[model samples]
Target: MDNFLETQLHPAEICVVCTEPFSLSHQPVALPCKHIFGHECIKKWLKSGQGNSSACPTCRYVVVEKRTPRVDFDTSSIWKALCDQPPERLNSLMMAIWPGLKILWQRHPSGNFSITEILDQAVIPALIKTARRTESPQDRSYDPVLDCYNLVAASWDSLGRPDTATGLAIAFVRLARLMSTASATLPKWLTSTARTNRLLWRANASLGIFELDVSWDFIIEATNLEEEQYFPLLHLYTVLVSQSIAHNSQPTPWPTRRHDIMNLVVERCCTKIGGTFWKGKPSNKFKDVLVAVYEELRRYQLEKGKMSLRGHDGEERVVKGIWALAGWTAKKVEVR
Candidate 1:
């Protein structure tokens, strides 16, 4: 069998933090926040007998590792890599994320089980052995996209096992927190910040929680003053949508407030961003997701063609299930 870390992978493919070539041999280990490090590093940390107090150097996330014989390499570069790679590395993250996203779009709520297994058994292990430690933030080290993809991978794992959602959510939130802590300490690595910010937002959104007192500070900081206004409403909408689904497998209350927020998101999607956004994107594009959601909501309200423009049910959610499609159609005429 070939060693996993010595394969002829591209330089861009190397994980900077591990100071090793990217390969498919050794297993890659993941921190709770979805950051991938060599299995060896994690093993060494465990052996250090930090007495379960050994935290991720970057996020300070504590994990109890079963220690054995292994060498310890510093993980200080994890934070810097995250901050530095957001812009140039966005495409890489997108590459890995897109594969997982495809799995969601196709299998979703179902194929998740098989996907998680593949990530754990194949992907994670292959990336572990080649890892090297970085002493400083200047390391152009490992692909941050890979780490981000690891986070998304764990997310796929959570869906198959909703019971794990809280743990994954906690990991993600801590990852964001680590970034904040690192940013305050070293301000230079702040280029492609938005990409990671959105990742954290979506992770929290998936947790089905509308209110997060713990996450509020990070939310305020991750977003600009203008975008910050969308925080509370968006968060609320996310939580309510999840709650509207089921409890004890029973449908909860009608999500009135959630529907209202959904309408707002649709309205925002309607705003033409000089055609920069929502063009050729899927129904789930942030610009158009709300409209898609609203259209679904409308189907429940209007009872098909019986809805009228002036009637309460008719006017309220007339095109809810089809709002996003309608919005797209409407945009064509406006553009013409």
Candidate 2:
């Protein structure tokens, strides 16, 4: 099974990361981020588990060649992996999570019940109970979302399930799909993130896990979020160009001709985006970067006679149903 850690079975293919097409001699590795690149090209990028280069070149998702076993059964990392895996790897994932998951798993599949059924029976009710506990007019924290997560983690621990974070995450994902889907009964409660979060938030006041509800507090936090700006347009542009020139040599040299070109292009585009930044709405900068990205890709094609836009993709999200305006932010609110 070619999991995230393994390379594909193809005899020959393009390493989209480096634009290097290698045959059987050197295969590109498929990353957990779902991007493929020459093993060494990606190796240099993820050579350190610390700092900027530690993440996937295109999407900035941190990629680790090897993971130390999580003694604490931490939820975040294990959650991301299990939320996406092949059916055959399910058993392995369960084992990796904890030895006790098998017990919980077996109780469900008496050859009739599905995994979802088991989660709904064993977990959702607990989630609902936890959510109810957190609802209050006086709770305060630097990050309310993190507080909610901590509470959820605590509640899961008391269940005596003796499971790992992976198990909890799997149960969480499975439980979410059963809720009224976004296009159906859930449009009123969910936004970009999942709706099942509030199952732990108490009695369907809002659905889904930490997904944004786009109300007042949500609007304020979104506006004030200090997270360094990320531009998919600039990200894709630089990633495509940078990996196209990565080499396996020790200290894998930076500042190659192509690398420098990528920097210049990104710098130029960012300047344009800054001028057009929507003053208050950081996300609106995407509109500016989109044009800059298209122009850059076009310019590359004109010079090289082959547009290097093969790595580009567009994603569309649907928010169906009448949305329920709910706000969950950790920002301290002034009662005024």
Candidate 3:
């Protein structure tokens, strides 16, 4: 009898919620717990926080479910071709990322480069998307060098380690340069990026020649900082060895053990002079140094002919070329 009464509707009885009798305005409605009350009265009870708001007023039964926490990640902007993008895309990246240059050019009245707009809309978004390659979407950490390095490595490797990813390299250089030391030295960000530069240097490095060949093509068109290498890359070994060896604390001298000394001096140079340098042509003082190392002239190695500049020492030093000059039969060119 009691169970039947709980289920039965008593329209003539006053609503427990509002102490009101059912009428046109006091319409009755049933709850999930099989309790009924005047429509507005029950709604006021549930929403008023007078007691257990989630439960039916009469039966104290929960009406709505408690929602659980969720993980929502969006991956739409990451380019699918990141690991295998073509050179043209890398070229575009080279042009797009350097806002500093755009800022410089925009100083002119006619400059139309929308520096902030382009970065907010295009450049930063693209780099952030690329940076996500190494990130947890939930954590979403932002590291400038690590982020730039990832894009650089992906582009260099995808495009067969081409020298054209200069913009990305320069950006990475700016980020990394200040981290290793307290005071600024040589704008030396490139030294910190050995791992990134090695992607390209690996080609000739294994053949017992360690060189990052710089040519006109590298500097041609718009470049990152128009980033001509500070040390003439072709004669870099000469410059590094010639300068550092005179200190003579090195265990073995040059020629007898070139690689060991070469490694030592290069390390010292990277440690000391640093390579954030991205402006000016290389000084040719090393032309006077003995030919302990050499190569260049794939010079027209791109075309059919090689090119050269008269050295301070009067022997022709490759200003632009491709073939590498080296071997046990190395010949010496005298400087005037």
Please state every model's RMSD to the true fold in angstroms: 21.8, 28.4, 18.2
Error of 3 at 324 (Å): 3.9
Q: What is the lDDT of residue 272 in candidate 2?
A: 25
State the lDDT of candidate 1 residue by residue for 9-120, as single tens digits: 3234444346675567645667786656667756565446444436674566766533443232222233334445544343333233333333433543332233243344
Off by over 4 Å in 1: 1-77, 104-115, 121-336
How do the residues 7-102 of candidate 2 rate in per-residue lDDT, one tens digit apiece?
Answer: 644453777556778766667777787777888877766654445566788787866434444354444443444334343333222222221223
lDDT of 2: 0.35
Each prediction's TM-score against the native?
Answer: 0.25, 0.20, 0.24
Leading candidate by TM-score: 1
- For every model shown, the clashing-pair count is 20, 15, 14
Give per-residue lDDT, candidate 1, residue 106: 53
TM for candidate 1 is 0.25
Which wins on lDDT, candidate 2 or candidate 3?
A: 3
Summarize candidate 3's per-residue lDDT along 33-121 as a digit string, tens digits. 77888898877666554347658866778875433343321111122233234434443343334333334335632323232333333
lDDT of 1 at 234: 35
